[model samples]
Target chain A: MGGVITGVDLLATAVFAVSGALAAAEERNDILGFILFGTITGIGGGTLRDLLLGADSVFWLYQNEYLWVCLGASLATWFLAPQFNSLQKLLLWADAVGMALFSVLGAVKAIQLGAPAVVAIGMGVMSATFGSLIRDTFLNRTPVLLAPEIYVTAAMVGAVSYTLLAFFEVVEAIALPLAILFGFGLRACAIIFDLRLPKYGDGR
Target chain B: MGGVITGVDLLATAVFAVSGALAAAEERNDILGFILFGTITGIGGGTLRDLLLGADSVFWLYQNEYLWVCLGASLATWFLAPQFNSLQKLLLWADAVGMALFSVLGAVKAIQLGAPAVVAIGMGVMSATFGSLIRDTFLNRTPVLLAPEIYVTAAMVGAVSYTLLAFFEVVEAIALPLAILFGFGLRACAIIFDLRLPKYGDGR
Candidate 1:
């Protein structure tokens, strides 16, 4: 049963790494930077998670192969970066999908750890953003999370949806798709439409 | 008994925060950035530690006063950054002292949580270096840990010393100062002499 659960986590990590590699690629970084960003984006949050849980070594530290996977993903993105440059809309689409998947997976891990709903949401955000946070930090940009952006809100929705579905014992296969759709779909729409949370005293 | 331990922890946190604020002050950043750097530098590692441990809320989150303290520290540094520039050497000396105190304190906390010696040592390193890591991240410089500098090794020795001292039934008051003195003293000496660890595969 746990094995079934862990497979989702691995998939989520791979996608998270891809997103990181893609971001670095956006800046046309060298190969070393790409892989470094990709791996950090992938492993940063989970490493913290395992360390806190006092689980045996960090998850990637034990598997070690995951490191190679991050490198491979970065290499793939390196080759793929320029190809997608012409397909501008497609790149945005890919990021949206990756965010959705990682968010749900993060919530799932938190639930597995027996955390309450609030904690599950926090973990979901961690899974989705902390790596990117590190990447932005390295790039010397104000982090996206700190910006007036729609990113974390999307992860929260995904996490909340997952938690509600689990509350009712929905089959994971069914619940996952719904959560991803809600999370990424909302995010893409927000980005595409220039939607924003209304600030206090917005003209609207 | 525990009250005294808590006092030591708070004092160390204050010292680290002061050094962090001073660093930001030296850069002459605006008020917001100073507060941001100071708070994050002071509480960042402990906040991270708490979050990773699956606690219901972050430690600082429960204590709102910590935020004000950090901000005040930042404000203080704002006035002092120029003053500190003249005493740049002394500020770094303060940082070393804070690092030494944190290494032992962090190790003690890890031990309290039943962490193994290696894990305790790692936590100590994390505690000592995490602020600098964040500072480097935000400042867009390569982190100090990546260098072959003797920074973390000094903390490691302190952590090991504290652990062994506790195992041998040494009093906290006595053991802590000894560990701190050895670590901080060594580090200070190394910095003064511009010393570094032997590079791997150096002529032995």
Candidate 2:
């Protein structure tokens, strides 16, 4: 079970790194910028979660594998930018999968640390979204969080469902996959239909 | 000495909160945005420092006073925007002082935790500048760190000097004030003379 979870985590990190590298490529940043953006986006969300939870050490400080994965993903994207142009839909699906996994895993970690359910859910959403937020912010682009999209809402759904399942004593193997699928399903629907949440003052 | 440090920390938090509120005002954000911006900016840097150091609890989590100070500062800025318009120079000076103090104090905290000198200096610079970086990023504005100004350099000077001084066994009473003044002097000069670092590709 732990092995499965770790695998998912690394895969998620790699996918996020690819997204970040693509963003840097779009900005015409140098190779150094690509690596920096990739590494930061890969590690940013988990770093924030661990810190807020007062973990003994940030996950990447002790485990170098994540860093290598990020670097590899970044270099691949940098050298193959043209190829990625045709993989946009595939990238979006991968991102959705990553977000779903991160949201559930983040909540599980927070719950293990004895955080309240609400705080755990918040951590989950943060863990799923903060890397992109950091990447966009550093690039001087408006963050996706500020957009009227169903992104964070999907993460929240995963978190809330997982927390509730845990509270009800559901086994991890069962609950984790269910929550991830639920979250990914919502995100996939949003992507397929170009769905958006209602904006503030939309009633007027 | 402890009391003095605490006072300075609170004052810096308040000053940074005011800056964040003013930024929100400039963006025409509502009152909720004002409070959220102020609170996040006030707490962001120190929280990052504490998390990086693996502190048992983040500084603001155990201390509610910081939150109140941010709230007060934000409300004051919101209601007195007109008054602040004429006090831009004063605000800049205050911000400079806050940056200088935070840089030294952040390094001191890292040193006390037995962090390496280089890491200590990095922490100091992070503590001084990250809040503003976060504020600018959330508001979709280019961060001042990228503006070729002497902003972060000033913080680095303070951190590096303080670390060097501490290594030479200088007493806190002297080292703290001297480092703060050194950093503030550099920033003040930059502000007064419109100094800038040479930009990449500027020679061409």
Candidate 3:
């Protein structure tokens, strides 16, 4: 179980790092910018969650593998972005998987830490989305959280489902996969159908 | 001495909150946006510092007063912004003071936690400037840190000086005020003289 979770975590981090590198490329930033963007995007969400939960040590400070993955993903993106016309589509699917897993994992951590269910759910959503938020912010773009997209909503649903399942004493192996699938399915539907939340005041 | 530090901390938080509210106003955000911006700006930097230092509890989490101050400042700005033509200038001065004090205080916290001097100085700079960076990101504006302005340079100088002073066994009373004054003086000069860092590539 631990091995599976760690694998998913690294995959998520790598996917997010690639997205960040792409953003840096779009902005014509140098290699330093690509690394900076990639590192933050890979780690920012979990870092924020750890800080909020008062973890003993931030996850990446001790485990250097995460940093290496981010760096590798960034360099790969920088060198290969020009040839990858379908990269955006690939990224969207990978991001959906990442978001699903992160939301469940974040909520699980918060629950273990004795955070209230609501706060745990909030942490889950934050963990699933904050990396992208930080990435977009640093790129001087409006964050996806502020958009009417179904992104955070998908994470929220996953988090809420996991918290409820845990409250019912559901087994970890079953609950984790179920919750992630639920979130990813929702996100996939949103992507395929171009679904969005209602805008403010009849689309103004 | 503790009371004095607490007072300065609250004042800095309030000042930063007001700056955030003003930013919300500039963007024509509603009252909720004002509160969100204000609260994050007031607490973001300290939160980041505490997380990095592995503090047992985030400062604002234990003290409800900080949240109140942020809320009050946001409400005040929402109501009073329309009538204040000089609010921008007032905010600039207040932000300078806040930045100066935060840089010193953040370094003090890091040193007390036994962080290495270089990391302590980094914490100080992060504590002073991250709130504004978060705000600018949310506002979709180029962060002040990314600009050619001398904003971060002032904070860096203040943090470095404080760390160095502490290393030399300077007393808190003398070291604190002097570091802040040096930082604030430099910021004031930048504001007055339109000082800027050299842009990339000899002005393109």
Q: For model 1, what is the alpha-carbon lDDT of residue B71?
A: 76
Give the per-residue lDDT digits (tens) of candidate 1, residues A1-204: 567556666666666677777666555554544665676676676676566545644665335556667768877877666655343354455556666777787788788789898888887777777666776676555665665557888878988899899889999888887987899888987888866787668895
- By lDDT, the candidates rank as 3, 2, 1
Model 1 lDDT per residue over B158-201, tens place: 87899889888799889878988888877887787876764322
What local lDDT does model 1 show for residue B52?
41
Query: DockQ of candidates 1 onward, in order?
Result: 0.07, 0.15, 0.16
Residue A116, model 2: lDDT of: 70
> Native-contact recovery for every candidate?
0.08, 0.23, 0.23
Error of 1 at B146 (Å): 4.1
What TM-score does chain A of each model score against the native chain A?
0.85, 0.92, 0.90
User: Across residues A64-112, which tens digit of lDDT does each residue of candidate 3 receive?
Assistant: 9999999999999889888878755765665677788888878988888
For model 1, report DockQ: 0.07
Once fitted onto the true fold, the runs of candidate 3 whose alpha carbons sit more than 4 angstroms away are A1-11, A14-44, A47-90, A115-122, A134-204, B1-40, B51-97, B110-126, B137-140, B145-204
DockQ, candidate no. 2: 0.15
Q: Tell me which of candidates 1 and 3 scores higher on DockQ.
A: 3
Per residue, candidate 3 scores C-alpha lDDT tens digits across B1-204 of 678778878888998898887776666565645666787788788888877777786776546688779889988987777777765576677678778888888898888888899888898898999888888778786675675558888998899989999999988788888998898888889889889988779757
Docking class of 2: incorrect
Q: TM-score per model for chain B alone?
A: 0.88, 0.92, 0.92
